[model samples]
Target: MGNGISNVKPSTERSEGGEHSNSSHPHKLDQFRYKVLKAATGKFCSKNLAGQGGCSDVYKGWLGYRTATPGCGLPVAVKRIKKQGYQGLDEWNNELRILSSFHHPNVVKLLGYCAEGVHRMLVFEFMCNGSLEENLSRECCREVEWSKRMEIAKGLARGLEYLHNMDPPVIHRDIKSANILLDHDFTPKIADFGLSRFGPQGDKTHLSTRVLGTEGYFAPEYIGTGHLTLKTDVYSLGVVLLEILSGLKAVKRYPNGRRIELSQWATPYLNDKNQLHRVIDKRIIKNVDMEEAYDFATIISQCLTQDPRRRPTITQVLHSLQHIESKHQHFA
Candidate 1:
């Protein structure tokens, strides 16, 4: 991780050889990206397209020519950037730089980029299982079991650990269920690094000019001061953990004129055994190990602490999850 000063300001000059530097020169890879986009989407075939996000559309594609090994052809997902202003270019570059360099089993892999003309595109490993948000909120899907949820939590933590422990540490400004993708076997992978930033070497805090992220997941400090850090991701992860356990959205308004955040609503249940039953998802309640559930809840509480300094590191979080899983096995 790049540790400079606690409150060092970000440089106006973008880093060279990375996505940030390429933002100003769209001509460099515009044609290539366009070709890939066209090929991936079959001349922009709407049928093959998966979904559209705020700034880009994702399409399912197969790259028969590029094989990691013999007969191991590449099945990829292409993200085609929509035309916007200079701000859009920055997002493209950020995704490219961050995803290109980020190599982790739990992180979505960036195959390559198509940077042709005014169009920009990114190719990633296709996630067969789709986003975590879809599995949680969408109907007709099988409920995720406790063991599967634990696996997802561990995978996410491992991915975050990589970012937090980088030489110049990376901060995933956006960490939410919607940004987490799963593979064929339901393995979790962190996707979408457009809002990410590289923290200064040794710096505890980094200043952010713009406050951008999904509502209810932002860290208290980041929301109040516009400062970003590794802990910010931890806070979001905590919210995700609660959602996974309780089958609740991070921000939900109850019927009794009360709007409660997932973290807040679940906190009271973490410590009290009587309240624990109330916080768990109804689908898994009967089958879940009570001790395992309590342990997992405690870990989530630590991650969601209001004080950034108190939030457990991703490494610590992973260890806790692993311990809980082992404990569950022992009792089983």
Candidate 2:
């Protein structure tokens, strides 16, 4: 885990309305007919399952939102809440409450949901390219070129920036590679906001809750104290950025039987340009800009700084990425 940072202040993002407010952004929270979603997912067939997480199972589906007349259904990703306890209910409500009105090009859009009886399902635009994690797989890497990697990272940063700048900032408690989906054009969209929590309000600096997040990616402060702020999510994003550069999972066990955390294993090289070759994905080393790769490492190093107070905000991260993408020779 990264070292802890204390006394980090809440972001001063302009609060236009309270967290979960939908006054200005009045996108109707569409309620789906259980039958419709069930049909879309081929009755939740195993073959259609796209992926599974701690709280939900995502299945590929086709859905049409036409009310008056029938039309061609759009391909969709259906997230079905797994049965647990009240925790499941809370997560379902959280995704519905947050994604119902949250709209951004880089953020996944919630088409509708199924709240009938005990069934809890969320419908979203289908991402053709699976996830950033899948793309990093040896087989998939053949398709995710250097330029596409930078584009995905930049899109993820912009999504975070939008959430951070929102009135009553939204902290996407989970920001790992698996949670980032890619569309047909390889456009990135941040997903799985089930763990997301609002940023601290008024004078409060952080939200205190039970520690919950992917191992290796959770900030040390959060794991130790349950105190979460925008920085907590930023730290996770830093982990994802590092994963993108190195093509490794956040946690790994090398063949030598040495188990290591990605953040700890990659930190040293991220800070030193001279050791850049030691950390970059070998597949892309010959295909990407070395200096730009170093710059990205520097940015991730800043983000992974143990002290949350010293980490650059999402806006700054986005701008730096934009600059890199513009100048990097990814003619790949």
TM-score of each: 0.84, 0.87
TM-score of 1: 0.84
How far residue 199's Cα lies from its native spot in candidate 1, in Å, is 1.3
> What would the per-residue lDDT of candidate 2 be over residues 1-332, giving only the tens digit for each residue?
12211112212233366433432243555678888888777788888888987678998887766422223478888899886655666787787777765777899988878877667788888898888889897777455677788888998998888888876788999889988998889889999888898889899999998888788799888888899999998899999999899888899977998888899989988878788888889987899778888989999998998988998898899999988876654553
Query: What local lDDT score does residue 190 receive in model 2, on the 0 to 100 scale?
Result: 96
Q: Global lDDT for candidate 1? A: 0.77
Candidate 1 structure quality by residue, lDDT tens digits, 1-332: 12211121222343334332212211211124465557655676787788798888888776656432222356778888777655556777787765655556788877677765456777888998888888777373778888898889898988888777765778888999989999999989999898888875553456565789998798898889888878888999999998888877888887897776777778877877778889898888998988788888899889889999999888899889888878777877
Best by TM-score: 2
